[model samples]
Target: MSINVFAGSRKALVASIALAAVLGSVTASSAVLAADALSTASTTVTLSAKINGFTNTDWLNGVWRAAPALSIPASTANNAAFKVGASVRLADGQVRKVTKVYVVGSNLSVFLDGAVVDGNKVGAPNVLSAVTIATATTSPTTSSPTTSSGSTTTVSSGIAYASGINNFTNTDWLNGVWRKSAGFSIPATSASKSAFIVGATVKLADGQLRKVKTVQVVGSNMSVFLDGAAVNGSVVGYPNKLTAVSGSTTETAITAPTQTTLATSGLNNFTNTDWLNGVWRKSAGFSIAATGANQAAFKLGNSVKLADGQVRKITAAYVSGSNMSVYLDGAVLDGNAVGYPKTITAISGTSTSTGTVTSPAPSAPVVSAPAESTAPADTTNGQPRLVGVNLSGAGFGPSVVPGVHGTNYTYPAESYYKKYADLGMKLVRLPFLWERIQPKLNTPLNATELARLKQSLDFAHKHGVKVILDLHNYYRYFGKLIGSSEVPISSFAGVWKQIVQEVVSHPAVEGYGLMNEPYSTNGLWPQAALAAAKAIRTLDSQRWIYVAGDRWSSAYHWPHYNTQLINDPWMRDRKNNLVFEAHMYVDKDFSGNYFDKAEVFDPMIGVNRVKPFVEWLKSNNLRGYIGEHGVPDFSPSAIVATDNLLAYLRQNCIPSTYWAAGPWWGEYALSLDVTSGKARPQLPVLQKHAKTANSCSSIGPL
Candidate 1:
């Protein structure tokens, strides 16, 4: 089974691939344009222009536009000469692709893709030229070649055959052939047999056009010979071509939807209202309503036009008992408050389609997340302020389960406990592999691994830091899920029972994290968690138990998938000492990898993602803990977001640990570990939020 491990090795590989893909797609097209080299096509326009200024109304949505309107020729203005996908070359030698273009009167506004890196100097004092490519007049013909008994047939003058083909090797194209490489394989499916037939004009990554000369296929392997070797430019492989701009004879004015107050009571009392098609459309105005019946409309794949005028797709949504909370493409809408009715003047009809495309609309005003809630009003007196970092290294080399301790995976250094404790962090989340501790199912803990864990705990106690025993297994044992017949619930519970018996009396031990980011494919995590908690209580009744919900224990998804933990009687902890744990990341995909620079950072993203989980805890009267949360140090906005998130957690009287700190995490973006005798950039942010209190009196109940 391919489990999503929390180690940096896998994340680094993913980041590398993502970075390469981005570079391969955009590097070739983003070259500096040569003067007087514009395409001769009638649709392409080269104009001398000056950049007046810049505007960043909706930069997150790629709405950063050049300010002060530029004069547009009357003849070209009506032809949609500055439409999206047009190439723009500024006088300062910077080239950008047009994302949006607006025309009013004789003035033109051009929105460009990318962030405002150089301030006012970006496109200043220079003539701007735009090339609007027209759509193809004719489609590529599809003609299959006739095959003779033992001879291969060549196809000429037809569309490039790309059916059933996922991707191609970058180096193969340079060799005038498309052959299977070590990094890639040609599909063996019948549909792929016709792909890349000879004579098909295939466009290379650098926009160069070429034709196939010959083709061969043998089972799962295939090779296509091109007429000539393709040049491997800055863009290494196939390019994702830009959309063509179509001309419009008539000019259309884009206007913002007028706001009108609805007659209904809004979200104040959602249960008393009726929901239709996922929205409550009154005669006066429109309001999005959340209920069980129309819950599908507010789901992840759905889109919504918020009051701010931005059309955003829902990344996540949870509706329960007339209450609804949703994330607008990872940004929390209305602090993710349940039943916090989003009263808007207008709303698009509930769309089942996942695409976020919409007709051109006026730029939406920028809006930040709701102001951080004050802590004094909500936080109970004497609540524990547990702040710390996740001490890693012990859970490494998961692929080599039960591998040699020092050679494959080693425990974190005992000195890290004092280093973090001196930094005012008193709680340490120690992650170790379950397979290493208990090599066999339902067996006693491994003596060597158990001793190593005890030594780490002893060091933590010496530094007066509490430890949360984090079982860094994704609710799996040897690639099998907890509830699977291969790894039964009894075996999982038995392992926990043995672990508690060994460390229940340790002074440094704070709680038993039942499992790290449990992902139960068969919906068996809740049952498995309850069973483990019961077994732990039979031995140690006082130590708190941390139970993570399903789906990688994502904070934004808690209400959607973990409500059963509160509603189902069987899933409840018998001792009422369970503290629900969730993890949140501020990246676009919530994967903690910050490889894409185009994904604009929003400071409220951290608050937005964790609000649903915090609200869920408050509504259910349960204690909560953030087991994992961190941001890359390179992003200033991400650092600010982390500070805001930590403040929000402090205000709510909830404790959290930054992920993570260890000797082995060299140059890790989110690592708080000291490097070259200097603290990492993210360490000071953790220090600012770290608290000395170690008591859990403030947090209670499962």
Candidate 2:
């Protein structure tokens, strides 16, 4: 995948190929490309500033897109990367223009002006995506991350499975059924199960192994489930007309997977700086450090394999002049610390089912709620439903507050829910950390927390609002959930047990979020997490559970995990329960529209921003919501970002809540009127414009 890394004012649009060159043997830089066609012209812009982490390819990608505006419509040669003799020219010339950023077949070479530079590129093979410059040597830039609506995806899971399917069956019937059934009341029609003939896109829920696919029967009536728990029979966007049909399986092309070479960055430790970098090194621990011109490997873990039987554990490591001191778990591996790769030795891990990793697709991707587009049109629709927010009570703030402070805050817990309930709010999001409820492994929530939780549930019940208690944090880095007391990763099951035992009886607690942003660094989530979810099913059969996307909930990352739902994936209380959730926050390119300085006054550019994500949800047959979104109100720069955001919601018809409410976020508050002191100028915007959710009237497309 091509990444756009920006370096200062200049943005670099590099692919995962072209970044193997050295610039002054200095710190790695993020650079953007300037367009200069090889057709026979030259327009150059001098490198102004530089920043680390950008590849030359990043600049190439940016310049290509921004070309129309630069008024320099340079043509591209074959989709080649730094394949010698490529150049570009601007209206005025001074800088060299590079095109086609592709890494040179892993040898890691760069064409600077014209010469090959080596011993410069470093880092893990995939961790640092490279760039390809038209020529060997090109300056670099970076892709600034802006976090937009469509790109950043949050995949949420549900608990539902059909019965009696063989090992690894695509489960086509179920796939079509789920999509057709998504966002609607079920049993509305008597069409044969064959009606759900169309196949679906497989999507992975954050941290789960069993991939699930949702598809729809054109013109069939169904039930709607928001975040896994049924919301209402009348779905806002569900279509009500079924098209008469023949059923057939749709097939797609799958390209043969190709093997790629790995990078060997900092390798002074061993003459062969090959198979022992990053975690691959059996050392005590490791951390990424930047050096003046380069970086190298350091140790933090214990008993590592180094050159010549070097055995030791790391005690400490810090910069000493130009090089890094090594510390093994007991000793350190002395070598270049900058530009280090994990390990050159080919190490492998088993691919086990964590839940659903890849969703099976029998048909092409569909991003709209199912309808017989070929059948009829129903312009007449229904009213939208009332909306609410998930402040994720009993949750956390790794960004600012970390561990236990959420409980310490009284403003939102005691005050905000009451206000939202009184404000005619329809929902409130409450995310729970499994580790918090059951501090001890295999145990349940301690008495104090249980009692407090029950009281809050009772309070919400008293007010006219529904509660969505989601398990926000899961077993992760360092074993415990982020921002919570440290606990063993295995403690997840214990926490689940505690939750079902304590809250299963309460009617006020409407739904549950399985885990918050379960990011599978690459794609799939950890397996243990899915098993914990299954256990939760045995406890509360009727509860609506939410599964999310991995990689911090980026939707782009979800497609790889999408799969067809198998029969009886999980049967809780005999109810076909749950909904899928996806979060949004696209990469910088999609969100960069925020910088359109053209608007002296706040001008909206994201009118089309929500299109991509909303379309994705509709096509997947998953009932979804924008769980979290917000900006520091003080950043007037976001004035346009904010305006574009609201417009995005209106255009896509997706519901969302600001990142927080009440006073807990003293610095990042959208508004403090509810209490907790996080009040900002954007309070009313959330109240009136947050998540435009509603019950479906006649059915089809909200």
Candidate 3:
């Protein structure tokens, strides 16, 4: 018998063979040669300005598809900690053994037993995954069993047994013929004189097992009840090669098996500082401050300590077909992997034919309905809530675009919208660059540009996703600020004038984000925001207009009394239709530049950080939206922070959208792409929030 295994490199594979010899070799040599190569190890871990958690299912799901390589950054000092044969866990909960370790330039790469991570060099976070150092590495010793069966071998009770051929004097099957049977009924006795009881296990000639639901014997006519119908056949006088098992078997009512699944959120807690300096210890508790990485583990319906050392129980966990849910105090916590792996492996035991029979084939309906929605139900009213991710490809090109930037952007297919729709997403923040809308100043919208944008909007609308056309230029145009004399505010407004006319009344076009992350230091951003808002208002008065702040539209900077753009008088008009927008990122410095924390549990950083901005909107009776916020792909703290942020948003009836979910963010430090097509450690968080906030009260009429 042969089993397949994955390793990081040839050398690692050799080490794996040695490790397997100790672990009692589960895989063959052919499988050992299938090790995938990873990038050679380098000196440091790569650092980038990447956020986490928020993933878009449209462009790419979170599943990791390619071979994985370690992209160790030049700054990482604990290179010795990671070695061939070390145990590591991927973001999707799969544990793998390291095969080979490579050092190329300043980066470190390796091969894993299974390649669950992406193998990219550019822009990817080059950090080793969570590692489990064995206390004392030792090899396995193989052993074999020797036993013999006696005349009367004990049939151990509670032990599962197969029902092919078994010797039992009490339980014996005699040949029987088909007869015209009616209602299900138990026979008084067997034709061979053995008791034909209801609980007796009987196997037909084809090896299918069925209990006597209601066996009937009418003058040598016999009927076996199964599948809610009775089988009619004539009873045979003798057991002619016909078999039957004595003991009953019960496989249903089994809970899913316990498996150690890891979430790719937080990096290794025991890093160089902790390992070399011997300062890894922290106050043991549930809070992020108290607990270090790998200190705890959980699954659906499990319990764990909170940041404050408070033991909290998982309120609910249930799997229905493909949909699985996990609740904390009745509120949904995102990232519950339901139906991915069958929780309960069917166990064979004694059968109990207590009236109702288990499905004869032992297979329940895997899918409740074809194309049934896994998304949450629609809101009470007709208007649906706008809970979704952003699609970010059209805005990828040159920020200062007089010089051409790369044009490798591709429009998403209709399948993308359908994918999100299936996940209960009703809103999409579609970001396209101003350069694409107008290649040169005062030029007509390009034919390809219009068609592509229109195609995206049409497809999204057709699939029930509302579109939010976002001009993601950061308030700059070809190296010129919007309000600067070089590119007057009118030029920016003119672009909207063309765009607004084209999509003003489209049913799917819910609103227009004037600009993404405007960072104008001067007071030019307020003027730019108003210019675009008024331009759109002229074309359509009722549609919502989103206006961002000056300093990157940051939530931390939104309420700065002196520089805040939301306080501008021009933004107060059409109050109900105008939504102030701001973005938030949580780290030690309130920037999404690093992913060092194992988890984030502080209300100060998670909820308190955004409280001021949300409160400002409430005090002014203004509605607002979180235009962008996301956590890292491999941090538990990121997940906690994102959940806290979203919970706060929903509690205050504020609507928000997650940042940069498109497939273009390959290996970006904050990408949620667990795979090329599926998301992990992030999608569950999004789904949990979407399903919990079932009310569309936050979203007004279109």
lDDT of each: 0.53, 0.34, 0.45
Q: Which stretches of candidate 1 lie over 4 Å from their true place?
A: 1-383, 570-575, 674-678, 692-697, 700-702
Task: Give the range of the ten consecutive residues with the poorest summed lDDT in model 1.
Answer: 368-377
Better candidate by lDDT, 2 or 3: 3
lDDT string, candidate 2, 1-702, tens digits? 322212111111110011111111101111111221121232232221111222331123122110111111111322232222223222233123231122222221122221111112221111111132222213221122111111222222121221211111122223222332222223333442322211211211121111112222223333322111111112221232222111111110111011121212243332232113432122222323325422222322112233333222223333322333333222123233321443321111111111111111111111111121110111111122224565543554322223453333221355666676445454566765544455555554566666756667656644434466766653253344432345443465556655765555443555566666654233224344455566666555444555555544434434544332212355211133444454543224332222433323223433343444456556644444555544445455454555566545543434454445543333322333422344466555555553343323312233
Give the winner by TM-score.
1
TM-score of each: 0.46, 0.40, 0.45
Candidates ranked, most accurate by TM-score first: 1, 3, 2
The clash count for each model shown is: 0, 164, 77
Give lDDT tens digits, candidate 3, residues 1-702: 111111002112322232233334200101111112112121122222121111233111222122233334323443454454444444333344444343434544444443234323211332345454222213231121110100111221221122221121221122233221111222323332143333333444333344333332323233333211122222222232233344322222111112233321221122231121111111010111112222223222233332222222332222212222222211111111111111211111111111111111100001010000111112211223546777765655342342232334545567667766666666778888788778887778876687788888767755656777888777777767877787888999989888877654344566788887766437777777777787776656545678777666667767883244555676764333688777777766555544355655564465777777777776776767777776677677777778877776765656677764654454444543322444567677777776563323233211
**Residue pairs in collision within model 1:** none
The residue ranges of model 2 lying beyond 4 angstroms of the native Cα positions read 1-386, 397-411, 474-491, 520-529, 560-575, 585-613, 635-654, 669-679, 689-702
Q: Write the per-residue lDDT of candidate 1 for residues 411-496, one digit (tens) a residue.
A: 77767877886677768888898899999987789988999998998777555567889998888889888888899999989998
lDDT comparison, 1 vs 3, better candidate? 1
Residue 433 lDDT in candidate 1: 87
